[model samples]
Target: MKQQNNTKTALIYAVDLLAIRPYSTQQLITKLKRKEYAPEEIQEAINRLTARHYLDDTDLCQRQYQAYINEKHRSIKAIKYKLMEKGFSQSDIQNAQEETDIDEIDYEYTVCLRLLNSRYIPSKSDKLKCQGYLYRKGFNYSAIRLAIEDFFYNP
Candidate 1:
């Protein structure tokens, strides 16, 4: 039947995509829709893949959080926004953070301080510029203020 054929094709496409990189369920749905797959066929493919443990949003969420933290050094807000933009649900992002048990506030301060230490030169730069940079980087005002103070006063 035409329906069966579409389902098969969708499954194959989904699997191929997953082989290249992990995708959240919503992202995969969007991709399949973009490819013009029928809604029923797309849903069937998604169900099968999820049953096969090939489409796990939770695991992907956790891994992405770690990747953003370790590789990108993003602030908590930025990481959450990026993950949500990638189609992860807010609850999933929160659960991932809980699973990791990260003290993100402390981590944010540390990251802010590290960034300041790396880029700030007392002679060439000013506190206002550093504050603006950290703000642009998604750091909270409190973290920015503390990092600036530590960089200028403690050192």
Candidate 2:
């Protein structure tokens, strides 16, 4: 009876957290553990949530990736790391990236162009600085070079 009550309480806590935002299974497990829920209770709550389709890492990955693309304008590498940090499996992240149709080179080019247009333009003095900034933002050397060339030659 005590174990059952703990499971129920853990489930309630998990549900409340989900109401705010989706969580990967590992994330929820960690949160519940931090709340002092026993391993068995946390696992039980996770199983219940999964059975109800309420705890889906794949869906969480997809939603997060889309938000990063549309709202944060993050690069693929950055998005991947963020998802991993959120406790999503590599396979789930790969699937989400595939579903989002994120072309690495094109996306990087677009992000670099947007950044250069909005904030950083590469002049003779600022060219290396701009390249380093883009690199820090998860863009590759080739994409950064192309974007800089496009910005200067076309603009």
Candidate 3:
């Protein structure tokens, strides 16, 4: 049947996509939909993949969070926003954060200080520019203020 063929094709396409990199279930669904696959076919494909344990938002979210923190040194806000943009549910992102057991503010403060030390020059004129740069990098006002103080006074 044509429907059966389409379902098989959808599953094949989904598998090929997964072979390249991990995708959230929603992301995979969107891709299939974009390809003009029927909604039923896409859902069937998604269900099959999930049953195979090939699509797990929780696992992906945790790994992504770890990479953002340990490898990219992304701020907590940036990590959450990035993961959300990648189609992870908010609860999954929160669970990943909790499992990581890192104090968000303190970790961000340390990263902020490190960035400032590496890239910023301490001068009255440059201070404002530096603050703006850190803010743009997803550091909150509290972390930015504290890091700037520590960078200037304690250093």
Candidate 2: stretches off by over 4 Å: 1-8, 122-125
Task: Please state the error at residue 34 of candidate 2 in Å.
Answer: 1.5
Candidate 2 lDDT, 25-124, residue by residue in tens:
9999988887887788788899999999999889888988888988647777888999999999999999988898767787789888888888854454
TM-score of each: 0.88, 0.87, 0.87
Clashing pairs in 3: none
lDDT of 3 by residue, 17-87 (tens): 99999999989988888788878888888999999999999999999898888954678988999999999
For residue 3, what is the lDDT in candidate 1?
A: 40
Which 10-residue window of candidate 2 scores lowest in summed lDDT? 1-10
TM-score of 2: 0.87
lDDT scores of the candidates, listed in order:
0.86, 0.84, 0.86
lDDT by residue (47-102, candidate 1, tens digit) is 99999999999999999998888864778889999999999999999998888766
